[model samples]
Target: MSVTRRSLLAAGAVAFSGALGPLFASGRARASAHGYGPLLPDPGGLLDLPAGFSYRVLSRAGDPLRSGEGTVPSHCDGMAAFGAGGGRVRLVRNHENRADAALRVPAVDGLTYDPGALGGCTVLELDPGGGLAAERVGLAGTAVNCAGGRTPWNTWLSCEETEDRAGASGYARDHGYVFEVDPADPHRLGAVPLTAMGRFAHEAVAVDPYRGVVYETEDAFVRPFGLFYRFLPARPLGGPGSLRAGGVLEALRVPGVPDLSVVDRPGAEFPVEWVRVPDPSAAGTPIRFQDFGPGGITHAQKLEGCYWGGTGVYFVSSYARGSEGAAADHHGQVWSYDPRRGRLRLEVRFGPAADVRLPGDSPDNICLAPDGGLMVCEDGGGEQYVFGVTPAGEVYPVARNAQDIGGPGAPAWGEFAGVTFSPDARTMYVNAYTPGTTFAVTGPWR
Candidate 1:
């Protein structure tokens, strides 16, 4: 059974009772826990938070960057936070623009990897109150640099979300790879692309720090539905920037299921397998993993954001109605991949349209909250919102991005990008995509 905004009415019942832990309750979720309660319209016409919560816009597109000749790059997407000591926080953000979004940031004299590719990463240091301290370009000359993950060692793993190869897409070098950046490094600014990570349309990633295992999601924005992957480092990552040391990449598989779209209903589970990807880089040179199809790899539609939580790796599957040849009909889905159990469970899912109105459709990036809930940033057609879903399937509104920055009648559609929190858990930070802006939110947490 799918759900919609009206379904939120049913959610109020579950939320008020605070009875959310049973996985079976997920299908019944309709309403939300809107953090602090229902959203109060934003008088400023930017973003709306619960009654006791408020936000402060810290950065935006075209603002003169702390360094460089031009304004900060736009299309601000995936981001992570690092403690910069003295109560300051550091953010590493991705500019998902492609080769055409050029000349935005001046490339360093001798540090960039591919001048033909425009996507890169920006590092921002914020004061204790979330005020911008300093900003600089951390990595440059990549393509479609989208959402990435944070390493346990305090470095950011920025991923390239494009399969545009050099010469073909006007790229000087092949694109689509992961790069590591140390936000706190004061001396130089050079990025090393971790070639071992597969070269598909990379989206965001999550690392199992305890095992040095890296899990990735593919954004299938192009041809061929995307597949979920994992990279087993040759050697357990020793510290920051160690991904370049090399590793083996593998895609997920079901022993005999034959298809990856099995994650249909809420709480649906499947046994998992990892098939080796000989040529993770997909580089033409000495090609090894030529037959990616021979492995009978299972496929899913638009595997998006992922986060390593206490129970497993929680990931999102953006809306799918079996369109683009997907095998099922799911508006949105959430799965938890448990390595110990060798299984992936469909923790939650939205409606199939024509039936349910679909509350919080097309969910993308996700992050864990202090209360053990998930803060989901929606990238759909309706009013953009950051929704909250508890372990027991009780959903709530965390924030409503009411900013109509896209001009008149733009469909009220906006992609809420980054959704992360400060190390102290006292402050929350998120980004509104395009005409990009970063915001810090604060309030009581219980």
Candidate 2:
């Protein structure tokens, strides 16, 4: 749901002294804020949270699945939570693995799309108290499952972040497509790829429930960068299986603005239009390299997480550095696209900082909080954290990954991903990219 300005201001009003403590008191996120207080040290050496908060390790990599077929997969990425009746919650999580992953998502009979591919999604049933009841594979046979968004019809969209084609990688077919996973029935939808949605390096997707339109982000880090896309389906609001019928895939184009990273200031607005992609499949050439006339498609570096808010769709460009072949430099940016007005506005932008481990850098996998704020996962260097950004743009740390499984001298801290909240807003779910672990944190939410 899109958060209202009034609600965000109200959430920002409740501030506590020393919001981020000494660690984050020197950055753009140093503004007065309200978090669950400074995170206390974790005794178990897994996760660090505020005094009154605690986390439970819901799933771990290399653990045995309840199905008894194979162990849990590594590199857990995107995920979504669904109501599973009787107050039970079901989680559909992505395993961003290739054939070389140590533990892969076991390919089940009906759910396997390609026996050679090793990336897919797993379903976790959590009881009301946040205990794992069952775990099983939901979708298999895809590669590099990254991040995806939930649909209005209560299903999860799993995206593959690779462009590996058939025979090139193994003995399978072309990858890099979006697959819908129904948490209620793991095998109902099967492993069919929504090809009309386009085949590129997809990072994530968000559905505009009102218009039934889907917004997509491409994470192509090469010179051509990546483009923001929208898929308009033939059957709007038809729920599951509606996207299979196919639709037009278009990329956002801003007149006179070829690269989005050029606009460094927040509140910068640009009138935008959608250009139809000549080839959704990009059989030979990639979509970003396709022709679009003198008025070309707009692109950005590291285009990542996105969600449909109350009025527009909020998306993130994790960062754009000049040294990295980008148009400009910035630590991070959050943009809002007003679909009705056909305009895009920069909501938040972080200034250049020498510290790479700050809470605001490389923000990924974002989701709207119940308190009218944003919970963003950090994909930066060193220690990783889940940062909370109030409507007023005050940033604070929510959770930290203290996965010290590699001994004291060798801490194994992985980037945070898949930051999401439960339906009741009482529990927050986050994933550690490496040493793949899912955490369910519950506490006094502000």
Candidate 3:
């Protein structure tokens, strides 16, 4: 059943009517209705899927492309697809290298940045049959092209997930902002870094069309924990391409945790609320939602991947370390935020036993399957694999990196980072970051 905003508001009101402090205790009733265990495999790698489904490499990093560009760079991260002129598909992919080494590219048309550091974006046009026909640099000269999302207006928002401004001389021009790119006309659009979105380590973005809101996640790993942010457009129902126009940025805050005496689990659901971050430009703003999980007084884990799926927004915590006195459960977690239901709920938690365990604790990008399932890319482990979870909570391996898992020239099958399905849902495209390669897989899902 599709839930409406009004129904969610009513549910929220009932949850908060008695006492906001125990709202989650009452929310348990709702969780029971949607609970499911993670489908990842165990540590020894015994997890396997049905025989029919398989994957193949479409393109890879360092692979000599038809474009004059010498070779694709390492660290292929976020990506998005758009329909092209001749029934083909255009893919805008990011290279997350922040080191002071020049990225080798045959041509520099869509490239940006200085010569020393190797980081930027690339656009590849794939023919209807899933063959790479043309390629070019999309946005060059950026640092750490982490993970970003697709815009509703047929564009890709590539986010730089770093806060380093060493080369900026004082103010960073584009260190930690989302860049808008047109995959169709890669050279025509000058890279416009959206600074008003806030200067933090952004992991991924999920736009809410109904509310005209862009939900973003911060991958802050320093002193303060990361924050879950929402960018409310000044106007109602604005186009996704206009995200750079500016909006209100707010942080998530769990009520009442000042004395350091309160005990709560980080995974425990709470009556969380959105608190405005008076000035996104101000780096001194206090974090609103801090320390509320299993590890008593824990902070928000590094939120990496997110997608809009089945009546809610699904998010993932790459890993959550235990706090002061709690047991450390480095396993990643997936949460659901039902805007229409006005409630944020925990859906699945993956530990060491799942089919695609996060042995290295780096869960990066995720995409929803057409059949109400999820496809996840593992960023940390030595053996990178694309894992899928069925709606029934069954986990299976869809693809594995055939090359090295990390660093340049890594195995393509070991480091799958981004996964997306074609509009028809008949084909799936997966990309590996370091040894940049995008592959198209088509088969019947048994």
Candidate 4:
């Protein structure tokens, strides 16, 4: 979503994706341009923001969740913000709980679709200054509810990150699918799954509002890798953005460019085409590989987050390597797809290290900033930080989590995720995955 700001200062930051090569702009040069200024250490030792910037934990795991039986769950992932009018806003967030998490998702009778599923969603309201107004469970009894998109219809689409078979792992029903939630109603959250969106290892989704189409990303991490998919709504003219209404699913192809892996460098261009998929629903074998085998349809590895912007749709391929069945190796890559031009362009390329890994530097969730830049959350090792990549291609640290709760683990850090900004751009909301926290950041946001 394009962040609308109260002042121009809130308009100056953003971030990227893709394979590795000559960056679109020198990372060093972008550094010189300045961000919120170096993040001063957070005296609280939890989060460190720029000098004038500050943050507050809006919610935390184990804390009581409104309208629910117990406390909030951890692994907070994707999120979105909606204006509540009168200097208020609501945040719909995803809890990426797997089928086997010890923490339970409260089941609200008929509102629950699957009793065995542990992943779900939550909602919190923020005041003008970013203080918590209210909080509660938004969706329940689902599994691997990862990253999803915000719909113009004022709804949140929470995607399940698995194509798990039914009756498996104590599940009475199949677990891979998407569920829609309304930010305003905590009492009547729909427990239904949007099956027509196609089932696979879903990462994130972005909606093309004008066309009523939803673009999806897959991070299967298997031999077949994952395919970038688009869903065409069955009732486009009706303007109903429900995946439950059903639709046709398609995979992207580079046409005559059979090899398909051109995402490794900045400015790499390719002719993009959409191939129709016969079935929109499948588990282990996604339609991409089933209908068009290995070389038949073009695809990439670890295709993760996606965001629909005014210019084009931005997407990312977290990291890739032959080990993960990738055609090439790189830390990550960012690409923009313009349906109008039927073209795909590589925007940012991180690295081509022999090993495609972002030990402590991978960009996961993303949001468009008011300045027309990108806000990125790193899901890698060590102390994780949220980065702001300016429209001019400069990247800088925006916020940091110094929570000692995670304590010396291999990654030694909590993954910063679920990044999104208030519609007014006056507040920035993000999540820390481990000791789950929802932080609302405010200050001179330029």
Report the poorest 10 consecutive residues by lDDT, candidate 1: 11-20
Runs off by more than 4 Å, candidate 1? 1-34, 186-189, 221-223, 284-295, 353-360, 406-411
lDDT scores in order: 0.74, 0.82, 0.60, 0.73
User: Per-residue lDDT tens digits of candidate 4, residues 105-205?
Assistant: 66766557788888888888877666787887788888888899888777888888887777876778887787878888754447877777887778888
Screening candidate 2 with a backbone cut-off below 3 angstroms (N, C-alpha, C), the clashing residue pairs are 2-309, 2-310
Off by over 4 Å in 4: 1-32, 186-189, 237-241, 256-262, 293-295, 353-360, 405-411
Model 1: lDDT equals: 0.74
In model 4, what lDDT does residue 21 have?
Answer: 22
RMSD of each: 4.2, 6.5, 10.0, 6.2
**Worst ten-residue run, lDDT, model 3?**
12-21
TM-score of 1: 0.89
Question: What digit string (tens of lDDT, one per residue) describes model 3 on residues 1-446?
Answer: 01232122112111110111121222212222121212223232322223354455666666765676677777777787788866788877877776643454333644454443356678888887777789877776677777888866777778777766645523234367777777877665566667667777888888775676777887754435567777787753555457667878866555653211122232345555676665565355433333234323224557789766545566777765555222344456676676765666555565433323223245668897655566778766455556655554444446555554335765323456768887667778877655566777777632
Sorting all predicted structures by TM-score, with the top scorer first, yields: 2, 1, 4, 3
TM-score of each: 0.89, 0.91, 0.76, 0.88
